[model samples]
Target: MKKLIINADDFGYSRGVNYGIIDSHQQGVLTSTTFMTNMPGAEHAVELANQNPDLGVGVHLVLTCDRPLLDTHKTIVDANGDFRKLGFYKGAFTIDYEEVYDEWKAQIEKFLSFGLEPTHLDSHHHINSFGDIPEVFLKLAKEYNLPVRNNMDITEDIKTTDSFSYLIETALKDDQSLNELFESNQTVEVMSHPAYLDKKLMDTSSFTYPRIDEVEFLTHPRIIELIDARSDIQLSTFKDI
Candidate 1:
């Protein structure tokens, strides 16, 4: 069987995001979520996870656009200790990776302290796309004995989106270690931001409502509900296989 972990990204960016994630998990197809430790409602998201017991929670490492956990004057997006913007799609920025590594380690430590031994790690903005950062992510994952989302979907459906397909293809080419992880049979987290068209989300971001709707109806919800809610459905965390 092809096992899948339907994940939701940006768990703590806003109250609306948090609400949407939890509601999607409870009422829709979301089986896992990645949390932004420094985002707006992180604590509440954790609390909800504790209550639900079935939601898989992982750290969504924020390195671009969003503020850093560590205060550094000369880093990429850190301008006087706050994030330069709220999105990273603009362009890749350069940073001193050596200094950033120390801060990244601390953030992981903080997440673990909250009783979430993350099963995997993924960057906030796919910042892993940058040079050497993917190496940092691999090192961190190995150190923690966790998985970094390998993003190896080669099936025909994934090819429909050229950008997404290209991302997966590049990951497959660059990530040799993921070969074993692929064979190990543990689920890799795959996420999408699908939502109803509403004033709340529309006013906040330029995310196309039409695309969101396409994902909502396209993702296999019935299968997800059956699998996630199965009494055989053992609760899974980032650390659980």
Candidate 2:
């Protein structure tokens, strides 16, 4: 059997987002989530995650469109202390490698402070896709003894809901390391954002409709809900394995 870890990203972004994530956990196949340390509702996400101890949580490292966990990088924030408007799918790429590393390290600290035993690391807006960031992120992941999501172009298979069938082909086309990681690890977490669109999310600069639909289809929430609600069930975590 193919074991999978489905992780929801942007936890603690907004109340709507937090509610959606928690509800998805109650109502869907959401086994895990990545917390945004710098967002408004981070504490709320933490509370919910703590309540649902079965849900795995990790750090959603924020380097763009949000305040840096470190004191540097005023470029990422405006005068009001609100993060700049570089939403996902449209952030302008920059080569601020030193700043990125500093901020990411601080975020790791922040996640630890929240008592989140992170399963892995992933960047906000896939910022690691920019110049030199991927190498730096991987280096930190290795140092921290955590797994990082490498770009394997799984998004294409994800779009078709044929992830099982096309994973190997897409992984080969995108990154060989990802294929090796998938093969070697008995469990791997795939970072994703799946939620219902509330006003806050809909009005946000980065709202995308396809992602919502993808969440609905890929999660298959109804089945999971029935199984858990109708029968005794125990969620598997890294510790379990």
Candidate 3:
């Protein structure tokens, strides 16, 4: 059987986003989600997770687009205490791995403090996949006995999810083509952002994203029809495997 891990990212972004993610799991195909510990809506996300334990929770570890959980001063962020734009930072690659490791540990500990045992680890803007940063996550994963998202391409032994764009495209594609295309693959993991964007979300993100549309697409009756028509594919959570 083909397994699919349908996960919604950014669980603790805003009220609209948090509620939308919960709605996706409750009324649609979302099986898992990753939380941002330092975001504004984290406590609310924790409450939602408590109400729904079956929705596998993971740490959406932040490395950009926000301040760190722990301090790195100028090493990771500017004097103004904000991270540089993703493109500028990606181009520089001047990061202190040890500082990064310490910050990630703090984030994970915050999750644990909330009594959540994360099923996996992934990063904001996928900074963990950038050069040399995978080592930090791998080390922490081993230390914590958690699975790191296969952003580093270690493969076969690591946990992972497919890109958000690819998953959205496939979901919005003609159903006739998707079923035939999936006939060959035994498993697929779809990463997604199924949310109702709030002004807070707009303020945090650099560009306006189509979150409401994505949620609509994920919960649409056509998606249900496509999934039911393919007996070979089973919707699964990360912990289910």
Candidate 4:
């Protein structure tokens, strides 16, 4: 059987994002999502998750995007104390692995404090896959006994999807069919960012307006019909794996 996990990233990014993810899951084929525990709408996201127990929820580990939960540190934060922007990671930058582990551990702990059992682990901007960070990421995964989104560079004995794809952008840009995307993989994780645009999203992320389009694409009737018709294709969540 071909099992597909359509996971929405940044579930707790904002009220707009939280609503968009829920809409996609309830009305569309989205099976799972990861929460940004440090985001402003985290509590709201938790409430929604509590209301919809079937939607698989996990922690979206962070090192970039928002302020850290721990006290300000030299390596991960800028002079203003917020996490350095994405560009900082792209260039020559220094990150302390110990700090990353501590912050991420706290993020997961915060998520657990809400009484929600997390289904898995992933990172914001794929930061956990960068440099020596996978060491820390895998350490936490083993400690927590949680599955992770596959990062090909990491060779540790960690639980993860067989393959991973950013389906929201690739599907729209290449017009690829679902079967082509899934190929021979029995278990695939397709990443998506589906959200309604709001002032917080607009100010915080440059990739804002396209999320509204993703919500539409994810919930499209044709996509739902295609999955339903394919007996070989089963929609699944991380927890199911």
Candidate 5:
């Protein structure tokens, strides 16, 4: 059987996006969500996770946008101590690897402080794969015995994983066209940003309107029917692996 993990990224991004993530889990096909530690609606997302323990919650390690919660002098952040979205690409700026590792470890610790164990770990904007970050997260995953997303593979210490496929960004057609997802014998993680558009999301980032539409597509009846028809496809969570 093909196991599919329908995980929504950016939980705790904002209240509106948080609501959409929960809505997808409760009313749609969403099976898991990853949380941003120091984002605006982090506590709310934790509350929602407590209320719905069936939905797997994982840490979404962040490096951009929010202010650094661990250190004040990290070069990754700007003059105001907030992460700069600009110089985030590879080889853009020299980075302090140890400082970044500590900051990321703190993010995971922040998530654990809520009295819940994370099922897996992934990064916000997939930052763990960029510029001296692969080792930091891999080390923590081994220390904590958790699964880091497949975006960065460090070795046997890190568990093997399947990378998530974005429905809209990829050429996979629409949300109902889910047949292509389970073509592999191995587990597959389908990543999505299913959310309602709100003023807060619009003001903060350019990734807004598509999320609003994704909520509609994910909750459609046809998608559910498609799943039911496939005896080979099994809906799953990250912890199931």
Candidate 6:
């Protein structure tokens, strides 16, 4: 059997994002999502997660979008103390691994404070996979006993999917069927950012507008039908891994 985990990232980025994620899970094939504990919509997202008991919620450990939960950091923050944007990570940059470890632990603790048992771990902007950061990420995951979204480089004995793909739009653009995308891997994790457009999202995120399209595609009848008709494909959550 091929297990497919369609995980919606940025669950608590904004009210629009939180609502869209819940809609995708309740009405579409999305089985799991990761929550951004530092965002403005964090509490709202947690409430929604409590209401929807079946949606596997996890920590979307943030390093790029918002301010740290703890005090200002030495390497992870900018002059203004907010997190440096994605461009900062793209360039040659230096970061303290210890700082990353502490901030991420705070995020996980905050998630637990809500009485929600996190299903797994991932990161905002895939920063956890960046230079030497996987060491810290894996360390935290081990301590917390949580699975992770496959980083594709780490060979450690961590729990994760066999393969990870951020190719939902690309696959659709190339007219590739979902089953064909899953054929080669026994387990696959498809990363997605599906949200409704809102003032906060447009102001804070560069990857806006397309999220609206993603919600449409994710909740589309055809996509759900395709998954339902395929007996070989099992829609799963990280908890099941």
Weakest 10 consecutive residues of candidate 5 by summed lDDT:
168-177
Q: lDDT by residue for model 4 over 131-177, one digit each (tens)? A: 77888988998999999998646455777887888766564233246
* Residues 1-241 of candidate 5: C-alpha lDDT, one tens digit per residue: 7777888999988889999988888877788889998888888888999999989899898887677777654678877778868455555678788877888789889998999789998888888888768888888888889976777656876664454576633412434445555444367777889888777788988788889777876677766665667676677787887
Clashing pairs in 1: 119-238, 119-239, 230-233
TM-score of each: 0.69, 0.69, 0.89, 0.95, 0.91, 0.95
So what's the TM-score on candidate 1? 0.69
Error of 4 at 51 (Å): 0.8
Report the error of model 5 at residue 164, Å.
Answer: 3.1
Candidate 3 all-Cα RMSD: 2.3
Using lDDT as the measure, the top candidate is 6
**What is the lDDT for 114 in model 2?**
86
TM match of model 5 to true structure: 0.91
Off by over 4 Å in 6: 170-176
Clash count, predicted structure 2: 0
lDDT of 2 by residue, 61-115 (tens): 8866546666656545567654555452254555456766777888888878988
Once superposed on the true structure, which residue ranges of model 5 sit more than 4 Å away at CA?
168-179
Q: Which stretches of candidate 3 lie over 4 Å from their true place?
A: 155-157, 160-165, 171-184, 207-209
Candidate order by decreasing lDDT: 6, 4, 5, 3, 2, 1
Candidate 5's displacement at residue 171, Å, is 8.1
Could you tell me the lDDT of residue 2 within candidate 6? 80
Q: Between candidates 2 and 5, which one is better according to lDDT?
A: 5
lDDT score, candidate 6, position 51 = 99
Model 4, 201: alpha-carbon shift in Å? Answer: 0.3
TM-score (C-alpha, index-matched) for candidate 3: 0.89
**Candidate 3, 1-241: lDDT as tens digits:** 7667777888897788898899888877778899999888899999999999889899998878677777655677778887656785567578777888888899999999999889988788888878788778778877776765544665455545442223555643666655554556545557788788788888878634677777777787877677767776788766755
Output the better candidate (1/3) by lDDT. Answer: 3
* Cα error of candidate 1 at position 130, Å: 0.8
